[model samples]
Target chain A: DTAVSQTPKYLVTQMGNDKSIKCEQNLGHDTMYWYKQDSKKFLKIMFSYNNKELIINETVPNRFSPKSPDKAHLNLHINSLELGDSAVYFCASSQWGGGAGMETQYFGPGTRLLVL
Target chain B: EDQVTQSPEALRLQEGESSSLNCSYTVSGLRGLFWYRQDPGKGPEFLFTLYSAGEEKEKERLKATLTKKESFLHITAPKPEDSATYLCAVCGTSGSRLTFGEGTQLTVNP
Candidate 1:
């Protein structure tokens, strides 16, 4: 069974188009995250939701928004996408507690978005 | 500011060759340090989590050790299947988010 899964493994869209990437995790984790890996392979966190509550919001542009209907699902919606948004978007989940080895995160098989 | 930097961005080794990868970080308060291995077209697989200095964990041919300011992932007799991009990330007391390094890509040839 796939622990974490994402839709639209490869997405190619034109500029100014809006797109959404869906993510779901079966690990029953409380924390979910959205990361963007640019062409330089630098992974940066964009947003994080803990138990469906917004926890971490980085310095991302306003065009990008993340919605978590519940703890098991997190979706990212990009509005009026630009060429600079072309990168690999990854979804990750984790269960954090006051203990050792509980901070490990399991990631989904990323969604590659290409804005032409 | 919190940051994680990995050295020797890419390395190529023959089968059975042994080497070590470095993960250096600068954070205000350290919560945990994590190591992950990522294959092409797939997500990252969790490997180890080091909480404090002098802590060590090993699996198969890989051993991870943590220090005050850095961590090392040592690989011995690595095979082709062990080749992947190793990522290091850290979480501090200020937040639950992780700051990730640029990752080191290792390639082992049989």
Candidate 2:
């Protein structure tokens, strides 16, 4: 079974439109995160939710928002999507935060979002 | 700012040959360093986690070693299937808000 899963593996949309991507983890991890990988393959963290609590929020556009219904799910919603938003968005989860950078993060298969 | 950089953007290797990939980082504190493998059109798969300087971890044909500011992933006797992009990430004291490198793509020709 897949540890982390994201829906709509391939999402093709248009600019100025709105879209949402969903992620779920079956690892029983307490923290779920959202990361965006650009054309350069630079993977950057967007948001992280710990036990359904927002823990980390990186420098992301205001058009992007993350919602965590519970510990097992984290969803990303984008408004007024721009062409620059075309990239692979990955969802990840970890069991606990070491607060000292000692934990391993598990990543999902990633959702390829294409804005045309 | 915290950053991770991997060298040799791409590598072409002959089967049964061995080599090492590098991952250098600039962060505030030394938390933990991670190693992952990514095939095309897929997410990264975890391989090893090194906690402190001089720590090492190994699995199958891959071995990971970490220092204060960098880490190295050594692939021994690599096979054709071992070809993939090796990604390194760092998560410091705050959380596993990992910062990933551009990744090193390895292509092993049998």
Candidate 3:
């Protein structure tokens, strides 16, 4: 079974279109995260949710909003996609404990988005 | 601000060649250091985690060692299948987020 999974492995749309990406984890983790990998292969954290509560929000654009319906699912909605928003989006999950930072995170296959 | 920098950016090795990748980080309070291997068109797979200085972990041909200022992923006798972009990340006590490096693209030629 896949520990983590994301739908729409590839996305291509106009610059002004709205889009969303879905993620789910069967690992029974308490925390989920979203990260973006740019063309240079630099991975950066975008958002984190713990038990459906927002925990970490990086300096991402306001157009990018993350929602956690339950501990197992986290969805990202973009209001107005831009060319700069085109990147590989990865979903991750970890079992949060005393120190959540020390936990090992498992990642999904990633969603490739390309905005023209 | 927490920052991570990976050296060499890219590396090339022949089959059976051994090498090490460096990841330097600066954070307020170090919580853990993690190593992940990512293949093209796939998500990163967890390899090891080093919680403190002098901590070391190993898996097959990969061995990760951590220090106060940096961490190293040493691959011994690497094979073509071992080729991938190795990412280094750190979790500082300041927050529940991880700061990742630019990643090192390792190519092992057979």
Candidate 4:
């Protein structure tokens, strides 16, 4: 079974439309994250949630929102999509470790979004 | 701000040829370092984790080594299927989030 999985591996929509990407992890991790890999192959963290609590929100546009229903699921919703939003979105999860603890992220096969 | 830089944005090596990719980071308190491989149109696959300096780990033809300020991913006698992007990430103990570098694109031609 896939440790982490995302739905709609490919999403194509017109500009100004809205979309949501769902992510789930079977690893029973307490932390989940959404990362964006742009056309340039630059991967950056968009948001992070720990035990369904918002923990890290990067300098992303307000149009991007993340909702974590539980420790094993985190979803990313986008509003008023733009052409620049065309990129690969990845979902990742890791077991929580305190100070001096080890953390390894397991990523899902990304969702490719294309805004026309 | 935590910063990570990867060198030689791209590398092309023939089958059986070996090379190393570099990942340098400047974080306040480095908790751990990670290496990942990403095939096109797919997500990143975790490869190795380096916790501190002088640490080394290997998997098949790949070896990961950590230093005080940077990490290295060395591929030995790579094959064509080894072509993919290698990513490096660093997490700071002082902070809970992970900061990632752009990634190094490697192409192993058969």
Candidate No. with top lDDT: 3
Q: What ordering of candidates by TM-score runs from best to worst?
A: 3, 1, 2, 4
Higher-scoring candidate on DockQ, 2 or 4: 2
CAPRI grade of model 1: medium
Candidate 4 regions with alpha-carbon error over 4 angstroms: A99-102
Query: What TM-score goes with each of the models?
Result: 0.96, 0.95, 0.97, 0.94
Q: How does candidate 3 score on lDDT?
A: 0.93
User: Model 3, range A2-93, lDDT digits (tens) per residue?
Assistant: 89999989999999999999999999999999999999999998998899999889899999999999999999999889999999999999
The lDDT per prediction is 0.91, 0.89, 0.93, 0.90
Model 1 reproduced share of reference interface contacts: 0.64
lDDT of 3 by residue, B1-109 (tens): 8899998799999999999999999999998898999999999999998899999999999999998999999999999999999999998888767889999999999
Over B5-103, each residue of candidate 2 has an lDDT whose tens digit, in order, gives: 999899999999999999999887767788889999998888988889999999999999998889999999999999999999887654546788999
3 or 4, greater by lDDT: 3
How many residue pairs clash in model 3?
0
TM-score of chain B of each: 0.98, 0.96, 0.98, 0.97
B68-101 per-residue lDDT for model 4 (tens digits): 9999999999999999999998888666777789
Off by over 4 Å in 1: A96-102
Candidate structures ordered by DockQ, highest first: 3, 2, 4, 1
lDDT of 4 by residue, A47-93 (tens): 88889998888889999999998899999999999999999999999
Candidate 3: segments with Cα more than 4 A from true spot:
none
lDDT of 1 by residue, B1-110 (tens): 77999988999999999999999999888988999998987888989989999999999999999999999999999999999999999988766677889999999999
Best by TM-score: 3
